[model samples]
Target chain A: MNSPLFFLSYFVLSALVLVTAMAAVSFRNLVHCGLSLAFAFLALGAFYILLGAEFLGFVQILVYVGAVAVLIMFVILLAKPGVEERRWGWRDLVGRFAGVGVSLAVFLALLISVFRSPSLAVKAPEAPVFSIAVLGEKLVTEYVLPLQATGLLLTVAVLAAVIFASQEVTKK
Target chain B: MLEDKSIYPDLREGRRVVRPGGKREAKPLNFPARRPWLTLGLAGAAGVFGALVGVAVLLFLMEWLKPGFLGEGCFLYAALADLDRAPAILLNGFLAYIASFVPVPPILLGILSALIVIGVLIGVFLSLFALTSVVERKVLARIQNRYGPNRVGPCGLLQPVADGVKMLVKEDIVPAGADRVVHFFAPVVMLVPALLVLAILPYGPGLVPMELSVGILFFFAMGATTEVAVFMAGWGSTNKYSLLGAMRAIAQMISYELPLIVSAVAVVMLAGSLSPEKIVETQAGYWAGIVPAWFVFTPWGFAGFLLFFIAAQAESNRSPFDLPEGESELVAGHLTEYSGFKYATFFIAEYVGLFAISGLAVTLFLGGWYAPSPLLAFIPGYIWFFVKLYSLVLLAIWIRGTVPRVRIDQLMEFAWKFLIPMSFVVVVAAAVWHYSGGGFLGWVVCTPLLLVPYLLFGSAFAKKFAPSGRVYRYSQG
Candidate 1:
């Protein structure tokens, strides 16, 4: 079903996604883990680009890699993980195993849903015209209500953050 | 027994050569001297060859492959269909035989063309970067009433080559405590975004490489990642100074980025499209075929241009906003731990970033790649682009030479309290000017709207910082 170049790109991107995701969780250093997470986000953006979601791809990078990743690193630096020896126990081991089991179950469910989807049988258009102008029109006209609601929600959240921060400053 | 002269030791002879007891004048080692002319000539020859080869390939692609094999599928084929030279026709006749056997030749041709374009662009800019460094040094020297680097190849033109060789030959060192992988990756990461933004910048008419619908957004998005690389460099070094420098750099970048984007928003608002090419097109018409109708001619555009210029200076870490690399305080800042070619890579990235930002500014406000007037159209578009670009670069160098670096607090205050607020005003001004149809009445309304805040801010800034009347009361007259 796939052309040679497209198939190659898909394979490479999926491999990158897996590797970066693994690296994100596996690194001991918080900064390293954060950078790894950023890489994973970048790979996801590349995936979006390959899927012809150009605007979505750029937004993915601009929001996640540019803003969120920087915020993650900042938080990690602020809350320094002190040098301490790990106190391993059966409780910790059991917790780890439980986490792995839950993740595996989720993965299996996702796979099942993907396999069951009817859309996979349908052929996509040879070339799709989903320009930024079309997306903008759709957002404003078709989905204006949801967009405004989301905007209101975000504004309130920001106001709450500012209030909390100001309160801490006043307390000191 | 014969002993190697290189390893001759005092113990074998029972007396040391040039010992403390003996008096001997130290002589210069017979090292091989550099042949500057030879190297320069070779480089010149290579450059000429490269240019000739690039032209030949483009000509071959345009004239030879377009008509029969492409069969109108290739977009450029129709545009170039009229080009039929004797050599080109002969080449096409020969190439047609080979073209018959290839399946989907357009795909292969497209990839090859893309590679060639990218290669040529990189070569051009890299050489331009070398020239810019020399030009900056010479200009700064002239400003300070001194000569700069006049020893190498006719007024130090070959200095970049020499510096490049030195950087290459130097030993690369990484601190024992450093994260080696990230440390190495940092320079690479830093260099990439600087070059990536260059791809979208339209240099001449029909010269855009990859024109995204969200072109400006893509440029800024790439620009944003350079801060991450700065952090990586600082954090990976395992040095506290590096970390501090990185923090300062990120803070500066983040603060200035707001105003930079906002000022650009004014242009984006006026143009009604994000594409650099479209932005340039919007600024196309001339006033009675005399004064070019560039955005900079407008009152709001003037304000936006000024704001964009200052913010861009900070964004690219040019002085008086270069606290990130403040040598007096932070020991080269985020670049403290870098050595050899890694350090050179950071420098290259910095200059490239500067060029890209300057290019964007030109595209947004200065009517990118367009000649100043219709009379100057014969000069060609790309030449006009570089002339404007280098003039901005020279201005940056002049600013670097004349102004002292600002304090970190003052820098932040200037960006947030001054530039950001003023940028918003500029946007409002742009909107006002646009709605009013940009006539005399629009200019009259917008000028005061811009000037009042600017004047107020300037006076307030001066009042806040300048010495008070009661200051130094105890000092004897």
Candidate 2:
């Protein structure tokens, strides 16, 4: 009785996610495809809540649902209109089937890998006193140097992103 | 306050200031002093009252006939056995509705009605503020030496109201190419999170409805919803700029959030609790006088506070960091395809976000609605909080009208390079400062010591700036 809500929510959320992921590849329209992907992200957030990964759930909602989905939408919107059409064919149908097949295969493999391991990992670790305060202490005391280095790493990445975006296109 | 130039201030004038277009089926956005929709309003009210009476009569009849339909095994059924009894559920519901309207006596009725009135007043305030786009534009206009929306009403006092009606009347167009369901839900998705954040905010002591122990956590939860909603709006629009806007939003939000949290960490450490009330109490007086114990007073706290402010601006997608809605770049970004009420929803969500973030900043750093000092303690908690928030909001608006939006790379660099590193330093400094029993003055003194290294090493960052310029020049199509 206690876990029934979670269980029901999990099944529903997982179905939504699976359908969306499948739709991402199956949809004839590219723009519709992006929307299905956004749906998958949203369902994943729901799944996070069901798993009791509250912080991760919010992070999922924030990063994937909010930022990433919004950005993707912007790119799709700004892209050239009337670029693609919904044309169905044996080739398209075959490719979609193949995509589904490959996805299923990979998913099964991942599931096997997870269960074959010593223990099934929960979504997030239960820190002893894990509020924002505890996270802060570890960030400074335990992981201070790596944390600083992450900043430097981010700086280099941003520099690199600029370089890639700016570099001239050359013939392959 | 600026004297309201609208016809509303002219109650004494008695000049029959009829709002043009007369009454309609729906309520106009304007809070009309004169009953514009008197007939419709009365009819609606009459219908509602009739329904309440009808419901109660039906409920009484049903209970008299069979008894166990609505309230199973309850005293209502037992009491109903005697023919005449106390109020039924329907009667109670009707009473609640009636009591909501009238001035109840000086008892529970009065108290309940007062609460309902206050809640409605707050709701109205929030809704009005949400639609205060005209004021923003006017202020921005004044800054730019132009009068905005003056043609709409008396200096455009009723501009937002007019705009609301326009939005209502406009065609709710759905692009044939777009995902209709996602498009429909997108604005709703965007609006819900912004509204929920308002719930956690301690408007003042004994003011907020839900005074949860983990108010900050609830805030964080709501904040995350904005990202998901933005994504939906972008993706549902089925456009390129929308996609780009979503990406920019994600990158910006995730990157800036690190510093935002880091800065907040210092506050949490100093306050030693997640509760907003506790944070305020801790900062009551700076060791019996001399200094303000607010986070802004500390060395690391200052650095953290600034970082937090910048990150908040980015988090809320405010200007300077508002790359998501770079109007010139993405043609209003994720909202390009949106129009009518849908567009209005997104617009409201953005401003509500601004208020929420500013409110959070005031709570965490500026001491959660507490007055500036003991000298000013006579000032109500909510007043100081609002003053701080409005000033912050003004700062945000000022920057919006003034600064050009940052390029994607520069925005990213600002977060990753400067904010990220600086936030960590602040965290460490706070921990060390705490260990040393560094009084409020220590935090005040150490802030400059923390920044001296930045002043010296800042010349190095100037060299890196040149490389980005060179890259852009080399890569231009």
- lDDT tens per residue, model 2, B1-477: 111123243233223445567743344334333443664477679999999999699778756765554565444455355322222332344445455456565356645644664565357546647345666767776787765555454455567787678777888887777878878988897887777777667656655545555567557756766666677677677798976777678667777877887788778777787676677667667646756678777677777778888899898888788878877678777887888889877777777777888888888877776667778876666667777888888887788789877778888877877778777778878887888688766656566767875564455555666544244656686
Question: RMSD for each model, in Å, please?
Answer: 8.8, 11.7
User: What TM-score would each prediction reach against the true structure?
Assistant: 0.83, 0.64
What are the lDDT figures for the candidates, one per model? 0.81, 0.70
Positional deviation of B26 in candidate 1, in angstroms? Answer: 21
TM for candidate 1 is: 0.83
Model 2 chain B worst lDDT run, 10 consecutive residues: B1-10
Native-to-model Cα distance after best TM-score fit, residue B43 in candidate 1, in Å: 13
**Model 1 residue B57 lDDT?**
89
